[model samples]
Target: MSTTSPRRLHLNVNILHSGFVPSAWRLAHADPRAFVDVAHYVRVAQIAEAAKFDAVFLADNASIADQIDFRPITALEPTVLLASIAAATSHIGVIGTASTSYNEPYNIARRFATLDHVSGGRAGWNVVTTADLGSARNFGRDAVPVHAERYACADEFTSVVKALWNSWEDDAFVGDKTAGRFIDTSKVHPIEHRGEWFSVAGALNLPRSPQGHPVLIQAGGSADGRDLAARHAEAVFSASQSFDESASYARDLKSRAAAYGRGPNAIRVLPGLTTIIGATEADALRRRDELIDLIPWSYSLTRLAGTLGVPADTLKLDERLPDNLPLPGGGNGNHTFFHATLAQARTHGYTARQLIRALAGGGGHRVIVGTPEQIADDIEHWFNGGAADGFNLMPDALPDGLQDFVDGVVPILRRRGLFRSDYDGSTLREHFGLQRPVNPHARMETPVVAA
Candidate 1:
């Protein structure tokens, strides 16, 4: 779309506990403790790295957002867990989520900068604003911050983090024995930032990270979210359900980025895709049915109700969704997921039961059940048709589902020249074809003249 060839496809695996499905833990091969075990995550990372995938992503929540009795929750602290993952895998990127709603800018800046150095530049931060009241309670608040206020805080929070990242020049470090110097004091400056949400007056203790600031990623789909991504995000992980929907979203997002003086190529829009692969289309469908059948109707209905912001009893399993359902929490509660769910139900006129099956694996991402060729075709269609740059793949089950994709689907994609056969670069930025950002302060000074 930005005069760049749209031939290469970038992919990342979203390591969702056992897998994306609620019943994934029930699978014969699934380790019930995979959610908490470091070995489980490291194994998944190794698989993705072996496949030459761009990255392996870890999504986080400050509070339990799902019914944990039935499914394993995201239990580990992401940055800490990803540090172990970084050590286990050498090429794949390690990206983890952290919320701006509850963290101070300085702490987040230092944490991610440390991750970048630890991972040899194969680190990324998924910026999110915690939206659930459960998380608010954990932070000693009675209610979640209003949507606008949260975004405002996030806007300022990200700005301060960037400023802190830029506080030290690239060559600020100088370890010289003869000169007896460790750092060039003149090359580092305190940020001295003051904003609505936070105020700080100091440079970061850490030097510039390997990838400048570790690729900034955002996942909100509201207008405010789009604006934030337009202004700051290098890549967006979106929840889009259809080709038309994703294409439109991509167009609108790029336009907004252009309005902010960023190039169309500057922001990559990768929609979420959940794949249930098998030897044939029918086998794939059977696998989908097996997973859906394992989930209790009560759990499914309750999950759907939560997304729709309605009581569980209000929904009838056999009936279509209520006409003109109101936006969840008056458009404040999980807006992206809410809209995506509604679109899927309304577009297909799916009954409640059908809708649950459709979303059983991915929440609201596009779900495809097919053989390797069919799955490859779906990915190619989206990539070439401008619906997505690539995808953040959520396999229906962990290691096994991912293995099926890598052994079956990935080879087809590679044979078609749509994906890489091997890693060409070591850093995540290089994997995504993005430039390592230059420090803004480095270009501001002119050489002093000796008269």
Candidate 2:
């Protein structure tokens, strides 16, 4: 609460296959093969970049977590796909998800560092702990680790990555042809790190990146998750359905970051938002219904049951969620989404079928169906009300859904002075108004002892 003018909003479009809805691929205009098409992704990114969006995010899972029979899965590797996007677009940031649970710290560090260079410092890493047993099994584990253990590993993983990124000083490369010196040997240092999770003798293969370190992002809602984010994350993709809940979460996260000696604005909380836009309210509702109608009840039920850790048959389409439903393993495996789904059910008394429609783009995040004016109002409310720094937008369909929002809502935001009308900076850090991190090992002073 600095009582200052509000910070400009930030938005990133999550390009989820064809779209957020399960049946988006079946839309008359959507290409069923878009999920595997690099051109499809590039087209979407170009659209977002043209609109002055801050970034385009791609979420990943090690296994086929979704019901692939009905919908397209998140198939391509994020970093590789983002490289193609980077070559196509100039300003928009490219963020890709990589799990701390399954991947080595060294490889993760090199991958993102390389991407940062390829994108000219417009790369971001969304740190996630793989929660599903399917992903664990794919990585050779029979079961997912307990909540606390996963976070412990993540803590170490992130630390090692940051250390490796700092191994080479920004000025390490002198490249003087007359002296035949390509690098300043004295300026390079090894991070000699050995920890429970990772061990690295560093001095990264590449020099320091343009943005120092690519922006670090996190998406989790459990106590451990929030603590990790407060300690390290520069941005958080949240799952909150209501304004009050989102606002409360923002305050708590900012306070936690402050306690860790970070500024109040250190972490930007961006809740997931699904928008189904139309020229009229009726038109929007009709489109939402059309998408919902295409999704089978069995698919929605099974999906919900998986998150709840209960039998699909146990849930009735017309009945309320069981009051005695137990929290999954003391709140593990998508803790944020499980609780958010429950909150929506209990607060609004939505029957299972109604709940499915309410969460047409799968649940957990908030959904808005309206004309551009109404959508703009909702976005303004969240940004001005301290409920969010911005949003991780998941449009109903790719290209088309994103096109509508960009053409419709973006102009409104620009008119109201709520968003930028043009690109203001070249790097992701500059776009988000984040400071580039200084290399901890670059310049240091030795302590003097008094005798």
Candidate 3:
């Protein structure tokens, strides 16, 4: 194995239904029942773990989100599902999405802390300010909060959550059976947070997690989104359709983080990548075409319309896109994808139909259809060419696709000295080469008392 100084590639499987393909469930051998089956999810998580993947991510929504009637919805709540996944797997990191817009800081803190403890520090939370207006009605509001307001609330929300995580110092818990003392009461304090959006009493009910706090992750590529990520996120999940866009995004994110008094390397900017792998290039292309064919043209057109803020009826399959469409009114929605799609369309002079085909499977995320070697080449090129630090892998199909990666691409990466063959540590922090967070009270240093 070749030893490298910059370290190996980090791969995380984004478990979105069967995979990144919109019609993944429609595949002949695909299990329709797997959508709700805990065992099916566990099986996929195991596959990812066997590949020594850094994490298994689950994107979530607050309420009945999107076209739930037609699409396969996110059925299980993320935390609960991650907990089940934690029980089934030992080492793979469990990352779950939670919306800052709908959840309170205290609840989020407790849920993630509990996950970390259960997973032995293999936990991460993908912090998001939810976008859909449907979620608002469920939360007793008629409309979703404006973009800036949601992020403003998120900033304070995350701060309070971190404070709560630090409520009990690392050494606070002592299982002293003889003295009948369970925990050091002096070491625990309430956060007493009173912010514009939320107020919460301090002191998380759970003890400090194995990693102190589960890794904080953020997604969304708007200006406010980037700002929030710079201040608090350890990882930022992004979507870009091309190397040029991904590289630009990486440069901007790192620079923004540096300006925030954090090291540029503090955050890992991983763009989502969906792969359609096959033994040969032609085979992969055929597989990709099959999935694309299954997508309803009407469904695809409607989605593109919503994302581009253009009327669906106005766009023609072969007609070139019009210049300068209006942006989403609330400054939200998938802005990253919006910009990326526009850039792609303008760069290639693609007709509306071509744009739909390109983005049909994975939205604006990069989609690759090739042999394992070809896929590896693309990943290496992106890593070395400044497009990304790592990649969020969304396979075209689950179980089988992941297996192909573990069995095929992983060995190629290992041979090229681009990935680790064996795990180096237990915690996600160790896996990511990040330092363990020091306890807040440790820096304060009260004198230790012996009981």
> Which lDDT values do the candidates have, in the order given?
0.91, 0.92, 0.85
Return the candidate ranking by TM-score, descending: 1, 2, 3
Q: What would the TM-score be for candidate 2 when compared with the true structure?
A: 0.97
Which candidate leads the pack in lDDT? 2
Worst 10 residues of 1 by lDDT: 1-10
What TM-score, computed on C-alpha atoms, does each candidate reach?
A: 0.97, 0.97, 0.95
lDDT by residue (tens digit), candidate 3, 186-261:
8898888887988898799988899989999999888999999999999989988788878988888889999989
Candidate 2 wrongly placed segments (more than 4 Å): 1-6, 444-451
> Model 3: residues >4 Å from true position, as ranges?
1-5, 443-451
Residues 299-348, candidate 1, lDDT per residue (tens digit)? 88988999889999999999999987887877778989989999999999
**Local distance difference test, candidate 2:** 0.92
RMSD of each: 2.3, 2.8, 3.1
Clashing pairs in 1: none
